[model samples]
Target: MSENGGRRSQAQRDAITVEIGYALFSGAFAAAVVFGAFAGPALLFELPGGLETLLLRTGLVVAPVLFVARVVSVLLRFRQSPQPSQPGRTSPDS
Candidate 1:
């Protein structure tokens, strides 16, 4: 393959990786929200005993915190990424 072709392929792979990362993050956040919303109320009202209570309470606290951290990390990484050049414009680095 030609040099430019290789670069284009690499760029496509990178783009796909970023997209998958975003999708996974979105799924994680959604799961966290669903679990927290459903379980929080149930735990508050029903009051499970022993290990079940500990597990549910731990999940209630951990899931949202982890989701927020994942979001922040993704945002920071996204901000740090360079913008793609327009079709007609030469990249500044080139």
Candidate 2:
């Protein structure tokens, strides 16, 4: 028994799992990079209180946004591609 009531094969499940893992990993990496870019100066240098607060807040907002964007983009792109989960769908590009 599986999540899909055993409707899909083990291979299909495995593929989906891998794709999800990839999406999460990429999202986390992108978020970390964006956060670092935004907060790096604030963290590294001794700046005015207002400026530091602004930079930190901006990083907090932007990082999450980028994370969601990356995850959704990857998953959506993956869904558009050919998959064994949906055997009949050969994808529009093909």
Candidate 3:
């Protein structure tokens, strides 16, 4: 029984670690995409006209602000959410 419990605990820890790893990877990927979308045109193509330069500059400024706002909103929603109760844990109010 003790060995089984230990195994379960270890599995839970491993799962949590995997989840955190995925979250980090996803965040990195999102950041890279955001950066690439805004910067790729400027770096990869020669701007033949002023309009293209203006558009790229505008996107570079606006995209990061929008992305940061979205991230903050999601974090706020997570913070406001109630956590699930563990199986053996009792609420203090109970």
- Measured on C-alpha atoms, candidate 3 has an lDDT of 0.64
CA lDDT of every candidate: 0.68, 0.88, 0.64
Across 1-94, the per-residue lDDT of candidate 2 in tens digits comes to 4576768777867877999999999999999998999899999999999999999999999999998999999999987876555576666766
Error of 2 at 74 (Å): 0.8
Off by over 4 Å in 3: 1-31, 87-94
Model 3, 5-61: lDDT tens digits are 545566556655665565555555566677677767877888777856776777677
Which candidate has the highest lDDT of all? 2
lDDT of 3 at 10: 66
Which residue runs does candidate 2 get wrong by more than 4 Å? 1-6, 84-94
lDDT of 1 at 18: 88
- In candidate 2, how many Å is residue 34 off? 0.4
RMSD of each: 9.6, 4.7, 7.8
Write out the backbone clash pairs for model 3. Answer: none
> In model 1, which residue pairs have backbone atoms overlapping below 3 Å?
none
Better of 1 and 2 by TM-score: 2
Task: Single out the weakest 10-residue window by summed lDDT for candidate 2.
Answer: 82-91
Clash number for each model: 0, 0, 0
